[model samples]
Target: MSRARAIGCDGGGSGARLALVWDGLRHEVCGGPANVTSDFAGAVAEVSGLLHRAAQLAGVSLEDLRGVPAHFALAGVVDERVATRVAAALPLEGVVEEDRRAAVRGALGERPGHVAGIGTGSYLARQGPDGFETIGGHGLVLGDEASGAWMGRALLKAVLAVEDGVEPATALTRQIAEEMGGVSGIVAFAAEAGPSDFAALAPRLLDAKTDSAARHIIVAGADYIARGLLALGWKEGGAICLIGGIGGKYADFLPTQMQKALVGAEGSALDGALALAMEQDG
Candidate 1:
C-alpha cells in the first residue's frame, strides 16, 4: 500500500491537528488536546488515534502509515528528554519538538522577527539568520506566564482575594464567584483543574472591559509577554507576530510601540509543522 510521504501534527492544550501529505494530495484532521508533559500516556494515544482516523479518511490502510516520518509539534514537550520520551512512545517514526519552532516558523517564516504564542500555554521565540531561539513555555506550573491558563489562574486568585477581603469585589469577581458556586466551589475547581480547564475561564478576562480585576490580570499577562520578548533580544521596530487564541488579545494591552511593530502571521503553526515534515522526509 502506498502511504503518505510525510505527516505533520500541531498539538496544544486546547486541541491537536494532524496532516498527511502524499504527492499533491493531503488529508487533515483535528483531535482532542495533547499535552505530552501534562499527560504523556494520554497524549501518545491521542496522536495514534488521529493517525488511524486520518488513514481511514484518506482511503488508506492503517498499516500504510508505517515508516512515514512525522514532525509532531506538541505543547508541554519543552526539552530533549521529553522529546525522546514522546518519540519513543508514539506508534509513528518521527521527531518530536516543542511547539514553539512551528509557531515561530509559521508566523514569521525566515523574516527576522519575534513570535509570541499565548494559548493554553505560552512560548516566545525570535527567528533570524541564526535560526530560532526561544524562552518560556515551561508549562503551567512554572512558566507560561502570558498564557490563557495563566490569566484563568490569576482570575481565580483575585476571587480568593475578594473572599478574604484583601481585595474589593468587582462585577466580574462577583459574577464568576456566583457561577462557580462561591469560594468553596472555586477552590474545588482549582484543585482538579488542568491547563485547558483553567484556560477555559480566560475568555471572561478577555472581554471584561470595565472589570478592574480582569484588567489587572490581562495587564499582568501583557507585561510578562513584553518582558519575555525583551529578554529574547527584541528591539524597537522589530516585527512581532502574535499567534494562538489568547495571543492576539494582548494587542490592546501591549505598549504602543509594540503594537506599532506588530505584524500579521504568514501562516499557522500547523503549516509550519507540515513544512518541517516534508523537509525532513526529503
Candidate 2:
C-alpha cells in the first residue's frame, strides 16, 4: 500500500507554493500567481503545475496523488462559490480556505491569538475558540491600508504632490519622479499598473529611509495597522504575530502598547496548509 501523503498549497496574488508531506518527510516547490478569483484558468494551471513539481521532488509520480488530500489556502477565494469553482478545476480531493485563515493557523497554530499579515496586501485576523474573524484585505482600492501596495500608492501620490507643488520636493519624491520617468510617466504607469506592479515600488520607500516623506508614509501605515488591532478586539498583552513581507518593518512603528503584544510566528502559511491537509486526511 502507498504511504499516507498530502499536499498543502498557499496561493497569493504574487505567487503560489506547494508542500508535499509523505512518509514523515516534506518537500516544497514554488509557482506563479494563483488568484483564482482574478484569473480562474491561469490560477488553476499554476497550482496544478506546482503540485506536479512538488510531487516529483518527493520522488512520487503524478498518479500517486489519486487518494492524497490537498489543502489550498488561496487569495481571491472569499466565499463558497469561488471555492467551488476552484475545486471543480482541480483534480484532487481537498478543501479550500481563505488566505487569512491559513495565515492565522500558520502563525499561531491552534493557540487563540491574532495575526497581522502585511505584504503586497494586508489583513488582520483573530482566531479563538469560536472561530476566526478577519478585517481589512479588501484589496488595494477598497482597503489593504497598511500593505506594501498602499505604501507604493502613497509614494506615487507624493510624487504627484511634488510635481503640482502641493508638497515639498523631497529627495524621495525627486527619486521616484526620475525612476518613473517624470509625472507623465507615472500617469501612464498608473493607467495600467496592477497591485503587484505598485507593490514593487514599495522597496523604494524602504530604501529611502532617511527621507521625511518615506518616514511619514511608513508611520501612517503603521498607525492604520495598530488601529486595526484594536478594532479586532485585540486585548492588552494578547499574543499577536506579524506575518508577510512588510510585517516586520511595521513593528517598530506600532504603538508601544501594541508592541507588547507582538510575538514571533510559530510557523508559516505553508505549515498551516499542511496542518489543514492533515486534518482533512483523517
Candidate 3:
C-alpha cells in the first residue's frame, strides 16, 4: 500500500498556514505576510516555502511530496480565474478549493448545509456531498460588509464622530483604541491590514458592543450576515455553522432569529483542513 500524506494550506491576508496530516498525526508549517490571490508571485513563493517547511518537519522531501495530494485553502481566492492563478502557484498534485470552502468544509467536517464565515472578511456558502456553492464574500472593499473590517471601519467612523464632536467617544471606543494601541496606531495599522487582522479585532468590537455606536455597527454587521445567510437559502431547519473570527467569537451576540438558524459543528477551519488532508482519493 502506498503511504498517504495530506497537505492543506490556508493563505489569508494576514498570514498563511500549511497543515500536514499523515498516519493520524497533524503538523503545521507557517509562512508570512502574503495573500496569494492579491500577490501572485508572493503567493507562489510563500506557499512553496510553507510546503518545503512542512516536508522538512515531517521528515518528507520534495520527492516525497510529488506523489502525495494537497488540498489548498486560500483567502481572496474568488471565482475560477483566481483559483486558476493560485493553482499555477502550487506545485503539489491534488485538489484545489477556495478558502471559504476549505473553511466550511473544515468547519462542517465535509458535511453539507449552509455556513457563514464572518471574520476579517465575510462569506456565506452552502456545501453538500455533491459540492459547494457561494452566496457572498467580495472582500472588505466591495462585500464583507458584516465582517470584522466592517466593524473596524464603523469603529473608525465612530471615532471620527467623536473627533467632530458629534458625540463623545464611548468608553468602549476608547478602550478599543487603547487596546489597538491608539487612534493613530489604528489608522496606521488599518492602512495595511489584511482580512485576518480585521477578523482578529472582532473581540475589541465585541467588547464595546454595549455602546450605542458599537452596538449599531455590530448589529449592522450581524444584519448583513443574516441577510447573506438567508440569501444562501439557510433555513431554520438546516444545519448552519458560523465560522471565522467574528462568527465563532460573537455567537452569543447574534440576533435570536439568527441563533435559531444554526445547529452545531464538529470542528473548525483548522480541523476541516486536517480532515480534508486525511481523505483519500478514489
Candidate 4:
C-alpha cells in the first residue's frame, strides 16, 4: 500500500469498485454500495473496509496507503461539505466527487461526445475541453428522469391512478396491484422505498411486451432523455454513448437520427476513476 501511487473508486447505489495502482500495475477490489446520501456512515465504512481488503490482497497493510491520493467517483454526493467529511474518513488522502463525471469520461474518454447514464439515477452530459456539462441527477425526489427509480415510482403512481379510476388499468396495472396486495400494499411499499428499493420494481416495466401503460411510462422517460440530450447541445450525428443499466433501452424511443449517433462505452466508471487518480498523482 505504501508503494501505491494512486487510488481510484467508482461507487454507486449497487456497489463500489476500487483500483490500487503501484508502478504500472493496478489491483482492483469490489465492495458494497457507497452512495453517501443513502447511508453516510455505511458508505464510509464500506470504503474503509474495501481499502483494507485491497491492502491485504496486495500483501500490505492499511498503514501503507497513508498518503495515497484517491479519486472517488461516488453516487449521492451533492454537498461539498459532505464530500469533505467523507474524505476525512478514508484510509488515505482522497477526494469525493459526483459519479456523473466518471460516467461521461468512461464512456467517451477525451473525445467530444454526449453521455446518457440511466441506472438507479439519471444524468445527461456533454464532454468537452472544459470538462463535463451536465443536467439532471438530482436524485429520486427532485429529478433523475428516465432513471430506473423514476420509472419504478411512475409505474406505482400509475397503478394508483388506475385505482382512482382516472387512468386506464391495463394488464400491467392489474398484475402489479394483485402482487402487491392491491391498493394498500402498493401504498405501503412506496412509503418505505428508497431509490434502490424502488428501482427493483423497474424490471417488470423493462420486460413488458404487450403492456400499454408500461410503454407509456417508459415513453415519458424517453421524452426526458430527448430533452436532456438537446439541452446538452446534441444535434444529428453527435456521438452519444449510453451508460448504465437502463440507458440503451431509451434509444428506440429517441428520434432515429439520435439513435444513429449512439456508440458503445469505451470503458466503465472504474476506468475513468483510475485514470483520474493517475492524473492526480502526476
Candidate 5:
C-alpha cells in the first residue's frame, strides 16, 4: 500500500512546530519565528524548509511529499487576505485555519468551550455548538494586553519607576533590566526577540510574588484575561480551558476571582493540527 502521508504545522508568535504523519506513525520538528501573518513570507519559508528537512530526515524527498495533505495553524493569520497571502507563499496543498481554531481544537478536542492561551501573546476563543469566536491577540506591541509580553513590559515599567526613584519596590529593580541585558539591551532584544523572550521573564517576575508590585502585575494580567472571557459571553457553566505556555505555567498565580473561570486542558495546537490531519486523511 502507498504510504499515506500528512503534515501539520502551527506557527505561534514565538516559534513554530510541525508534525508529520506517514502511514500510522508521526514525527515532529521544531521551527523558529514562523508566525504566518506577522512574519508572512519569512514564516512560510521557515515552515517550508522545516517540513522539507523533516521529510528528508525521514528518507522522503520534498518532491515525494508534494500534494501530500498539510495543515497549517498560523498566528497573526486573521483574515482571508492574510491566509491567501500565506497560501501564495507556501504553495502547499492543505487547510489553513485560524490559529485559535487550531488551539481550541487541539486543547478541547473540538468540544464546545472557551480555550484561553496566554503565551508570549494572549487570546481567548469560544467554540460552541453554533460556532467559534475570539478576543485578544491583536499583537505583542498593541494587543496581547495580558500576555507574557504584557507581564514583561509591566515588570520593566515597574523597575523603571524604581530606578527613577518614583516607586520603590521590595525586589531588586536593576535585576529586571539586567535580565534583558540592561535597558539598551532590552530595546535591542525587542527588535529581534520573539514572543518567548518576553514571556520568559514572567517566571522570574513571579519569583518575587511577595512583592506587592509583582503581585499587582500578575493580578492585572489575569484581569485582562477575564475581560477576554467576558467578551465571549460564556455561560457560567460553560467550560473554560486554559492552554499555552504561560497559561499552564502561571495558572496558579491568577487572581482568585478569575481562578473559578478555568477548566484546564490536555493538548495544544500541535495536537489539534495532528487530529485535523488525521480527520482529513480519513
Candidate 6:
C-alpha cells in the first residue's frame, strides 16, 4: 500500500506557500497574494495553482492528489462562513483555518506560548492547556495594530501632520514627501491604497535614520504589539515568538519586558499546516 500524502498551505496578504509531504519527503511551491476576505476568488485561484505545482514537484500526479489530504491556513478567514466559501471554491479535500492558529502551532508546537504575527496584517495568539485564543486580527481599518500596514499608515499620517502644521516638519517627513512627490503624490497613493500598499511603506519606516518622528513611530508600533501580548495573557518571562515579514524587525524596539519574553519559533506556518494535515489523516 502507498503511504498517505498530505499538503500544507500558508496564505497571507503578500503571497501563498505550499508544502507537500509524500513518501517521507517534502516539496515546496510559491504562489501570489491570498487574502481570502479581500478577494476570495483570487485567493482560491492562487492556492489552487500552488497546490498543483507542489504536487508536481513532489512527483505526484494531479489525479493522485485526490487522495491526499490538504490543509490551508489563510489570512482574512475570520469565520466559518468564509472558510466554507473558500473550501467550496477550492478543488481539494481539507480544512481551512485562520492564519493566526497556524502561526501559533508553527511557532510553539503543542507547548503553551504566545505568538505575535506582524506582517502586512497583525494578530496576537496564545496557546494554553485549554486551547488557542487570538486577538486583534481585524484588518487595517479596525485593528492590526503594530502591523506593517499600521506602520505605513502611521508614516503617511506623520507626513500629513507635518504638512498641515499640526506637527513640526522633520527630516523623515521631508524624505517621505520627496519620495511620494510632495503632498499631491501622497494623496494619490492614499486614494486607492490597500493593506499591502501601506505595508510597502514599512521598510522605509524601518530604514529611516536618526529622526525623532521615525523613532516615535517605531516606539508606538512596538508598544502596540506589547499591549496585544499582554492582553493575550502573555507574561514577562513567558515564551513569545514573533512571526511574519516584519515580526523580527520590531524585536529591538520592543519594551524591555517583551524583549525578555521573545523566543525563536519552532517552525514555520507551513509546518503547522502539515501538522494539521497529518492530524486529519490520522
lDDT of candidates 1 onward, in order: 0.87, 0.86, 0.72, 0.85, 0.75, 0.85
lDDT of 5: 0.75
**Per-residue alpha-carbon lDDT of model 2 for 132-242, expressed as tens digits?**
899898889999998998999999999998899999989989978998899899999999987888899999898787899999999999888888888888888888898
191-252 per-residue lDDT for model 5 (tens digits): 78665676777887767777777888887877777667777876666677878766765567
Colliding residue pairs in candidate 3: 106-272, 120-199
Per-residue lDDT tens digits for candidate 1, residues 63-99, read 8877776789998886799999899988878889988
What lDDT tens digits, residue by residue, belong to model 4 across residues 43-135? 988888888887887777888887777789988888798888888877678878988787787888768899998998888899886567998
Runs with alpha carbons beyond 4 Å of true place in candidate 1: 1-5, 38-42, 52-69, 89-92
lDDT score of residue 140 within candidate 4: 93
RMSD of each: 3.7, 3.0, 4.1, 3.0, 4.2, 2.9
TM-score of candidate 2 relative to the true fold: 0.88
Task: Give the TM-score comparing model 4 with the true structure, all chains together.
Answer: 0.87
What's the TM-score of each model vs. the native?
A: 0.82, 0.88, 0.78, 0.87, 0.78, 0.87
RMSD in Å for model 4: 3.0
**lDDT by residue for model 6 (142-183), tens:** 998988889899999999988888999888799898999877
For candidate 6, the TM-score is 0.87
Pick by lDDT: 1 or 6, better one? 1
Q: In model 6, what lDDT does residue 36 have? A: 97
Off by over 4 Å in 2: 1-5, 52-67
Residue 147, model 4: Cα distance from true site in angstroms: 1.5
Candidate 3, which ten residues in sequence have the lowest lDDT sum?
273-282
